[model samples]
Target: MKKFRYIVCLLSLATLSSCDSILDKGPLDAFTNDNFWTGEGNVSGYANTFYEQFLGYGNAGGSGDFYFNSLSDDQVGRDFDQYPNNKGVPSSSTTWRNGWIEVRRANIMIEKVSQMTTLDDAARNHWLGVARLMRAWQYYKLVRMYGNVQWVEKSLDITDEGVLYGARDDRDMVMDRVLDDLNFATQNVKDVASKTTWNRSMANAMKAEVCLYEGTFRKYRKSEDSQKAPDGAGATKFLTACKEACAAVMAKGYSLNTSYQGNYNSIDLSKNPEMILYKAYKEGLLMHSLIAYICSSTQISGMSKNAFESYLFTDGKPLALTALNKTDKAPMVDGHLSLKDILAVRDKRLSQTIDGVLLYNGRGYTRYNVGMESTASSGYGICKYDNPAIPEGFRNNTTKNYTHAPLFWLSVVYLNYAEACAELGAITNDDLNKSINLLKDRAGLPRITTAIGFSDPANNHGVSDLIWEIRRERRCELMFDNNVRYWDLVRWHQLDKLDNSKNPDILRGANVANDMSGCKADKVGEYIDGSKASIRAYDKKYYLYPIPSGQIALNPQLAPNNPGWE
Candidate 1:
């Protein structure tokens, strides 16, 4: 029998009756809120409830985190003109509701854990750290979306309406509190044996991520309001914190997996050295459709032409500056390079991430190729999460596909460390070797040194040559995983890259003229539902999402919706 874990416990808890008897008079045998706080097991079980919410590979049949960047410059979806462009002011948002819900849950856990007198100091501190970590995670997300969110440390009742409907706190104030929580988590969260559970390393990783975001956001954002930081706490302070946190994780003995492709397309990552935390999916108990989505003949979205071209050549030089691109013109076919040729000279990760050849019905590695299947919108199919080893039956069934999802990994920490160093303006070649060069070595590219003085002409972000290269490496390494690209753009204050009018490359897809037979010679871009891919005009207001209209109405303090929306 498979060992029942957090996910199983969560599923079992969901099926329980919500009757008054069960609510008021908690069952003696089963764990309830009233009885659950008595032991470590129950406290751990409660913490498990947050795992699915924060870490799990999304719903079985959904796109999961793979398509999160569809709204950003990295990838273009079938609905190209969706969010950040056509986003509307809603009355309420699940993002707002669910965030507060999770925050309350974390606060409740902290309160309950504190009340437990039986637990030893170590155990109590561990559980408290877990709760604080969770709270910080939610707040970090909330702050990212809404600039100045209300900071609630404790659970509030209806009687505490003043606290509930209080004015939005300063971003710096909330982030400082978030930093405090992360510090507590990093110091107190035990180093657990289970890779799936939260540990001290994971806490440090989370802190690094949070600090980098805030630090860069403050440094890059032009808005005076957005740049505000608490006394003695600004970009330098947070970035230093980010650097130290990353260094803490680096000392924990994590390394990159042998194959870059194996990181994403794995069934078992429990023992993978790169993984700090991963969501385990059993064959029968819990599975996801991400692998099936990649393997199936379904018309998935593709990376943007800009994203595809961002990968550095094998020589660690951008295409414009690479001699290989100038010398070898054979790859060029009908004004665009063939998919095979494109993947050949660029970073090895390109081939691992995207299909090297056009795959359609009765073609390529797909097993269940129904005639109704269509090619990806961009003609550049995403193969990052594809696993060819799974049997035919399993690939076709959404729920049966059992690929593990990496929630946190060492590569991200490496990127975090490198970027933090670069942003701090004190990066050394030794720092590059310790962080970015390791990733370069894994990607089979020439090692980058601090003396890389040449700048890519594509440096539209106005960053230094080193910073630009670091950002590119980050983009390539973390593509199609989570919303890294989107958030990176946001923090760097470069969302204008999404403007199709300004950056036409973002809307362009694969060069399908040569390989895809029926594709028009003139129309080289991805077509969706008989229309070419496009994005609406970009606005500065898109930097921060609008606080829901209803939320503003209820509080009035949240008036003046995010910049352009007003």
Candidate 2:
């Protein structure tokens, strides 16, 4: 379709009387396909739809029930009915879980933009890449959540029952299409932009994450009836893709922020180079519940002691090996072993990520002894995303503080590259400097070397001690972020570690509360015993979520839910 320049000439007295010809001019109120898509601004405006639809913000509203950082072993929420606990889930409803609705919107934009003859090749390709990037992101999230789903590429007729109620595509086939979309996006998207915008950096980051997830997810959880295109037990191919994608972004010169907490709790994102992509929030225009969540009395989702125990000793050795190894920390203000001692001897990230004290009305209230029982039951004060400046203020008053939430950062790219290479058995010391060492430096821990790894061995990962440490770095650095630790457990087939039946000690932590005066050492113990917390246990069936019962009813093609989900 060749676009012609549309020039509107206002009607005058002479032309007004000639109403027959005057009505032929373009209408001033609305745009038809002929008039729209004739300028860059319109096309760009259409592409902007993906941002608000697919992305989320700091303390944002619609991210219901998915504080991924909170629902796993590392962080525990008081609401025991959330995911992995296997309660409070929908029995059936395809409402939007598979993301077909979002895909339909993106495909319309892609198709409309492609048909615009007014757009130059560069403009068209760039816009297309943006659309594809979003499409790939949505599909990846869907597949991860629902296994395989109906793959739709274009807007469909509502009355067309066959297309609307069709059988689902295989997960591997859909993911291959997802990768193809990502590949196109990486090659064509813009390289420089605001942290909130999509670009090649985001594309590569998605590729690194998606490919590595697919690779590990396939290796750890595949069944006899799974997608067979990317066949075999090894995750080498996708891991290689993950490694190269991460390296490509690293080449763009993003580095770790010196202050571990610098990337978060900011009013703006202009200065954080480490955040390759983030959700920008402007106070009054687009603020969220981050402040509310941190300060609310209902803030039950607190960090777990497992997370605190995961941090390495200051000397880069595991606390498991240090003097702090299960040694009762200094008796609490209440005369029980508590977190106070660990804060002093552990890596610098401990205090930065968790809170030990709160300043209230110019007086300091300790997290352990103070009356914060309503906020956290296990005595772990989750202060990671708290407004760093407002310690005394809880449930922050609607103030002018802008909280920019991070989505993707360079450290993830580094970790992704390092782990993928490690999985391939091709990582080296130079690779460590390029990837893991950067995080070690940020955490003020010693760097890894062949000699260092052998001298001080890691407790997990048969691959190598270095690989285990790399995994540990990821666990600590990305802790409380939710998906990283939980997903890593899935891909590494380590969810069994969460099982109290097999690992009876999985749920133990310091159970401290009010009035420290009479508190004895015997008063402190595990928050939930093995008999009561049955939901924390994991089995092979938990590897993949069940295809919703509602979805199967809508189309029986989805029946015979994933392994144990039935």
Candidate 3:
């Protein structure tokens, strides 16, 4: 796969600037339009650029998708809360702009793949599948952000005026096209032996994810903006698609990695059966600072109280109703449950995610105090991506850590299967056995059956007991990975959970003792609070991001910017 690294550089010379430009030109020095598509290797090399563009682990000084939960209810930053405030509208958006650039690149590949006369039928279809898959991924991102974006299937020339300045397509219509591309990819893409590259299994994984999102988004989000499916059969159609996609991936013989912690903290996932697709990082060639972000003394962010309490006890019950609550019996540290005691009664994954020993400024601290020097915003230290075996010198340095990042895995597929079944009101004990129970087994907890009679007092999302449990499993399993929590809230139409005025738990952290140094005695034994001003009250318009004002100005057909941004 190291060849992909160099191929991306070579392909960049042929990449177009945007979708609205004339795409007839080719690289002058390296290759021309006539010669680049002459071989299968060049086609594969052209597709290699999408890997770096779409599935990057992290750059030198940034934690890529690992900490994206900061924008959701799972975590909060130290300087301020991580909620989006009412900033009116933006003049332009790089996400909106860069998305078109990649879309154009993918469209060019799709068009050029048909011109590869030397390749066999199998080879040509494989390249076309790869190109369509990349295009679908970019459009999915666009739809997730700005609801109704123009669906451009081909690389448009400057003479194409209607598509360049046209009204945005309906959400369901564009998603159906995305679904078509995904179906094509799943059928035509060969199953590559390498885990890092795109394949039939990866396409299935992505299809399951995209369908589940669209299904739930339609079921929960209500509006009159023509986002609904035309035939009024939106939720069931996409949820069924999600279910079938999951089943296809499950049949591929992928299993959970025995060590739950090893999934994220591993240096090499090349042979891990759990990983369907991952971003490979070499020690010196491609490394990231995610481990440094986790292990450093810098005040990044930490898990929120809302997220911490979502993990169920070993008996598979919420902490409020569980008999296994150890707050009274466990040893007290600074008037709070000791980290060890907290780990004793709760799910094992919690211990794996957060460090048990408190550290301040890279030194051990016995007291679990909030607002300390090295403690995160919520006082809970995140260690999910930390490899403890790495030397302190390298772990603290930027771009030095090389832990592989999981992009798509079997656990997520399992969760998606369970959720799709539950959402379609077709889940059963058999579904539980095959999906959520496997995760429960890995966490060393009791298996859940459909006969759950107890209702969690903490469940305020208005879902049934079984569906809530399945959602909880997803939250715990995918804690800080790749903005899953935030998008989950969005697709469920539950962004109101981030409002601290109604849900104060989002602003609270670990309880502190009066005697702990630097602790505010008056606020001791109470929720460690964040500033209220940091969170914006939820608005109905927040469901879809506002389209760029500059774009709407350029093309008046994109008027009436999202719901309330007008």
Best by TM-score: 3
* Winner of 1 and 2 under TM-score: 1
Q: Point to the candidate with the largest lDDT.
A: 3
Global Cα RMSD, each model? 6.3, 8.6, 5.8
* Candidate 1: residue 543 lDDT (0-100): 72
Is candidate 2 or 3 superior in TM-score?
3
lDDT of 1: 0.75
Sort every candidate by TM-score, greatest first.
3, 1, 2
The TM-scores, one per candidate, come to 0.89, 0.82, 0.90
Show where candidate 3 strays beyond 4 Å: 1-28, 224-232, 326-337, 358-373, 514-525
lDDT of 3: 0.76
Model 2 agreement with the true structure over 257-361: per-residue lDDT tens digits: 877776666666668889888877775576566555555455445565566577888767775576545542334453333455657667777777766642211
Which whole-number lDDT from 0 to 100 does residue 282 have in model 2?
72
For residues 203-256, could you state the per-residue lDDT of candidate 1 as single tens digits? 999999999998898788785435443232488889999999999999888989
Clashing pairs in 1: none
